[model samples]
Every structure is written in structure tokens, then in C-alpha cells.
Target: MGEKTLPQAGQRGAIPEKQAWKALAALCIGLFVTLLDQSLVAVSLPRIREELGASINQVVWVSAIYLLTFAVPLLITGRLGDRYGQRNIYLIGMAIFTLAAFACSQAPTIEWLILLRAVQGFGGSLINPQPLSIIHRIFAHNRRGAATGVWSAVASSAGLFGPVIGGVLVGTVGWRWVFFVYVPLGLISLVMVARYVPKLPTGTSRIDLLSGLVSLIAVLAVVFSLQQGPELGWTWWVWVVLALGVAALLLFIRMQRNNPRALVPLGLFKYRNFSLGAFAVGMLGFTVYSVNLPIMLYLQVGQGMRAETAGLMLVPMGVISVIMAPVLGRLTDKIAPGLISKIGFSAMIAAMTLFGILMHLQVTPAWLLIAIVLLGLANAMCWSPNSTISMRDLPPELVGAGSGVYNTARQVGAVVGAAALGAVMQMGVDSFSFGAAMGNALLLPVVFLLAGLLAVSRFK
Candidate 1:
């Protein structure tokens, strides 16, 4: 199969490997800038709060709203890449994100910031799934792992690197600079995409607008209820909204199963690796997003570390991930992903659990670094293999749908993680020592990672 010629979407013959890789690099820059921009925002949260006079709850919305908006539109956006050209869709989304970043920096209040972040999230959703489609279209099935590895490396490393860059921006300039810092990177990504990424052929798949709206409402309801439950005292209305969200979600699933224009083609889940990959990545999303703000808050507010120092403390995560992704990415092409992901999930579980334990105990700060290192290792192993395993087997026509579903799972996990953690942290802070509150909140990710581990354990 590797020996057979596979043409690019608009070509007569095989797309040169060099051209495929160059296009992937262009996509990586866009992914990296967005992830870096978002992750860096965590380090700036305290500063954002101080300047805007936002309550801790309002602060959580800055992150949660982004994830919620980002997650809900993804299925549609994935199809957008299929129906319109990936490069064209990517350019439009990147333009929106860059403009929104500038708008976010200019926001005078927390409400404004939150609103702008939503626009930014929607833009990110458009950007996220294109790489999946383009990579699959351009790379052969057997070699997809290596291409995916490069993509995953940028994605994972960007999140890790965000804090370090964010700390510097926050410490020297201000919180607004964190958003401002990305404008140039975004512009550069736009230029590179224009220069490198090819215009792939669009598919005939029609998007299901009704299903999209239903899915959005379901996600918004659940995330809103979780985020506001503590503030609202978990009132009757909160439970009502939560229940409605669950019911609506079930309805959406049923709708997809029957609807020909389904946002998620339920049939795709029939592939075991695809199903497990989506599940595992969701757990990863839950853990990764849930842990960030709490750790930043714990270190900055609880331990009183300087923003730059605290950001620097977490740099090892990105550093380790960057060093290991290429190696592990290649490994996914040869080895059993089940074994690789097991090692990753175990490390993640240990790291988050240990973080909670030590934070609850208020142990010395140095001890926490060990957990960070584990997280880095977990990130390196989890992203590439899971991504490689998930979509490589799909028919080319289904790549966009598969990517959308896979990424939606991830962002949905992120949405739940951020919301649930916010609620937990708010409760913990009220009743316990700050460190203990953060420590307890860390356990949520453990439960998520454990679930993911069990899912991947069934992989062939």
C-alpha cells in the first residue's frame, strides 16, 4: 500500500512528500499560536481579575466560554473544511481569531473579554479540524502517524509553552499583552497558509443546521449550569437546566443516528480505534484544561510565586513534550498504541493525583515539579498515538467527519473539565485551605484519565 501512488486532492499524481510536510508545518504554526494564546491566558487570569474587578467565578468564564463555544461549533466546522476548501476555511477562521484577539485586548471589562473570547473560540474551532482533513488527504495511511506526530507535537507543546510566554507578557507588560502577543503570529500563519496549503476539493456533504443548534444548546446549558451552580447555590433552576441539557444531548445523538445530514455521522463510531481515540482524547482534554488555572492559582495566590517564576516552573512540561513527541510520534507508526497510551494515561493519573495530594498537604513547592514532569511525559505519549490510531483507518471521504467528532470530544471534555473544576474549586475554597481546595480539585482529572485508560486498554 505504501508503494502505491496517492495523489493530492487536486493533483494528477502523488503529492510530493516535501509539499505535504510544508503544508503541515503551515498548519502547525496556526495551531501553535492559538493554543499558546489560550494557555498563556491562564497565567494572566489573576491579572485579568485584578484589572477588571472580576469575581473568581467571572474569571472562570473567560476560559469556560471559550471552550464551550470552541467545542460546540467543531462538528460543523469540520464539515466546513469538507464542503469548502480546508485552506480557504482555515484562512477565514484565522482572520476571525486574529481580529478577535485584537478586540479582546481592547476590552474594558470582564464581560467584554468573555464575549470576545467566544468569537475567538469559534475561530479556533474552524482552525482545529482542518489539519486533520488536510493531513489525511495528503499523507498515505501508513505514514499518517509521522505527519500526525508533527501536528500533535505543535498542539501539545503550544499548551505547555503558553504559560512560560504568558508569564513573561503578564509580568512585564500586562495581561492584555498576552492577547496582543498573538496578533503577529496569527498574521504570519495567514500568510504561510496562503503560501503553502493547497486548495483541497470540497465534498458533497450537507451540514445539518438544526442538529448543530441542538448540540450547541445542550453544551451551553450543561457548562453554564456547572459553572454557575456554586454561585447559584445549585438551585432548582440549575438542576432543571442540567437535566434539560442531558436530555437534549440524548436527543441530538438520536437525531444524528437518523438524520442523513447529521453533524456527527454516528456510523463512524463503529471503528474501535476511532471510538477509543475520541474517548481517550476527551479524557485528556478534561484533565489538561481542568488542571491549568488551579495550579496557576495555587502557585501564584497560595504559594506567592512570581508570575514569571511560576510560569517558568511549568516550562518543563512543554520542554519534555517537545523533546519526546517526534520520537513517540514515529513509534506510533510501529508499536501498539494501547501500550503507549497506557503509559501516558498512567503518568497523567499519577501526576494529577500527586498534585492534588501535595497541594492539599501544602507541601514544599519543589515536590510539585515532579508531577509537572510526569504531565509532560504523559502529553508526549498520549497526543500523537491517540490521534494516529483514531483517523488513519477511515475512508478518505470520512476524514473530516472523523476529525470533527474526535476534536469535539476533546473540546467537550475541556468544557466539562473547566466548568466542573470551577465549581469544585469554588466549593473547596469556601470550606478548606486554599492548597487543599486545589488539591481536591485535581482529583477530578484522575477520574477522567482513569476512564480513558480503561477505554484504550481495549485497543488492538
Candidate 2:
């Protein structure tokens, strides 16, 4: 069969292994660029703030809006993939993301940057879920765990190396270069995906636009309130927004229950592992995205390190994750996924707690580097295993939907982390030194991880 004529859905047993791996590579490249953009901008935030003359809120929104837009449309986008084709939607997303990256580099003001970031995020939302869904369709059950491991490794590696790349660009060329750098990468990924990734058969399921709108409104209200609450002195409007968010969420759930074509089928939660895995991944997202900005600030602002030096400090974490992810991924196939994930969550909790304590004491670089290494190990164990087990039992036809929900949970957690942590950090800064504020903010990840641990406990 030609590249465009793939085996039908649920017929992965027939696809050639060589083509499967090539498709995996194409998907990883797409995933890498999108995830790289997520972390790459983080280290450059301070530079962007200075150049754009943005306030703290605006600076955080640069990150938050991207995540927010990325998170909200995932449910619909996943269904779109099912209706269209995963490879088709992924290519479209890559094209949009690449163009938006160029646009972001030329944005003249913070507001324009935020708007462009939102567009970039829309492209990301299109690209993010298809890889996992495609992997599920093309890879055999025996090797799916390993595929997820590779997927997780690419994501973690992006997170790890993004700051270093950003630091180099922001320090040497300019902050705008951070956005410009991804344009070429995105173009390359687009070409690879079009050439290599098989065109999977599409599903005929209709998407529920109302559920999508509700989800967007709910997430926006809640995240905006949380991010602005501390700065705004927790006014009545903040509480009002929070309440509106909660109400909208309830309405969304009710609508999902009533609609046969729900954006998120409530039935997916019937499986204990899927439910638990979703929660755990969300916690991981919260910790991973929330922790980066504070760590960058602590390194650059609090310790008086250069952007390049601060970015380099994160290299060990990435290195460790890159080394360990595949090993853990293969192990996930043999081991009880819950057990592997529990070990990961425990290690991450310990590492984050240590980071909090070390920051409180203002420890030397050596101690901090050790903590970062531990964090990397924890990350390697956490993401792939949780992802593997979450969809382990999902029906083949629902793979696209499941991937969407799983990714949506992760991104929503990220949105919460960025906003809520920003608020917490602001509060801490108001009452204490920058180091103390960051130290205090570190505790939030610990709390999120503990909650994840609780969810993982229910996995078996």
C-alpha cells in the first residue's frame, strides 16, 4: 500500500514494522518541537519581560495563554483527528505552529505576543494528541510500552534541553530568537510527518461543539482568577470568577453525561487505572511546568547566575532523563505499571521536598545539581509508565479520544500549575525574600505530587 493508504483502524497487526518506526520518528519530531516550544520560552521569560516592558502578570500570561489555549481545545481536536485523520491534522498543526513561531518572533508588544502564543497553542493542541493515538494504532500491544517510552523520552528531553537552547539564543542573539529558532525545526518536522507518518483511517464520530465551548470558558475563568487573585487582593470578582468556573465545569460534565458524542466520554473513567493515571499525569504536569520558572528565577535572579549558566544547570536533569526513560519504558512492559509509577512519584516528591529545603537554606550549586539529577530520574519513571497504564485497557476505537483526554488532563494541570504557582510565588515575594518566596512555592509541587501519589495508590 502507498503512504496515504494505511491499514484500517484496529488492524495494526498488518502494518510493516519499518514503517511503524519511521512514523514514530516523525511523530516524535513533531512532539519534540511543540514540547520544546513549551519549555524554551520559559527561560527567556525574563528577557522578554525586560524587552517588552511587561508586568509580572503579563509575563506569566505569555506562558499561561499558550498552555490555556493548548489545554482547552484538546477534546475537540482529538475528535477532529478521528473524523479527519491523525496524520492530516498533525501536519496541519505543524504548519500552523511553524508560521505562528515566526509571527511570535516579530510580535512588537506583550499583548501581541500573548495573542500569537495562543495561536501557537492552538496549533499545538492539534499536534499533541495524534502521536499517541497513531502509536496506539500502528504499534503492537507488546511494543506499545516501548513506544510510549520513546514518546516520553522525547517530551522530557525537550523539557530538559529547551532552557539550554533558549538561554543560548536569548543570551547571544536576542529573546526573539527563541521563537525564531523553532520555525526551522517545525518546518523539518512538517516535512518528515508528511513523508513518513501513515495516514490512519478516520472515524465518523461527530464532535460536540457546546462541550468544547464550556470547557474553554471554564478553564479560562478558573485559571484567570487563580493567576490574578493574589495580585488583585482576592477581591469579590475573583471569587465570583472562581464560582463561575466551578459552575461551568459542572455544566460541562452534565452536558457530557447527556451527549452521546461527549467531548470526554464519561465511560473512560469507569476503568480504575485510566482515572487514576489521568490524575497522576496531571500532577506530573503541574509539577514539571510549575517548577521550571521558579527554578530559572532562583538561578538567574536569586543566585546572580547568567542565563547560559542557569540553563546549563538543568542539563544534568535532561541527561539523566534521556538515559533512563527507555530503560524504564521497557521495564514498564514487564513490571506492574502502578508500581513503576509509584516509585517515580515517591522519588519526585522526595526530590521536590529536598529542593524546597535546599532553597530555604540557600544551598550551594553542588547540592542543587544533585537534587536536579534526582528530579530527572523521577521524571523518567513518572511520565511513560503513567501514560502506558492509563490507556492500557482502552478500546482501540477510543484510542484517539483517550489520548485527547489524557493530554488534556496533563495540559490542564500545567495551566493550573503556571497560574496557581505564580499566585503563590507572588504572595511569597510580598512577604519574604526572593529565595524564600521560591522555596515556599516549591512546596506546591510537593502537595501536587502527594495528591498524585494518592491517585497512583488506587491504580492497582
| lDDT, residue 109, model 1 | 93
Clashing pairs in 2: none
The lDDT for every candidate, in the order shown, is 0.82, 0.83
lDDT of 1 at 452: 93
382-403 in candidate 2: lDDT tens per residue?
Answer: 9888888888678756777888
Model 2: lDDT of residue 383: 86
Tell me model 1's lDDT, rounded to 2 decimals.
0.82
Off-target runs (Cα >4 Å) in candidate 1 are 1-14, 49-61, 108-112, 429-432
All models, RMSD in angstroms: 3.8, 2.5
For all predicted structures, in order, the TM-scores are 0.91, 0.92
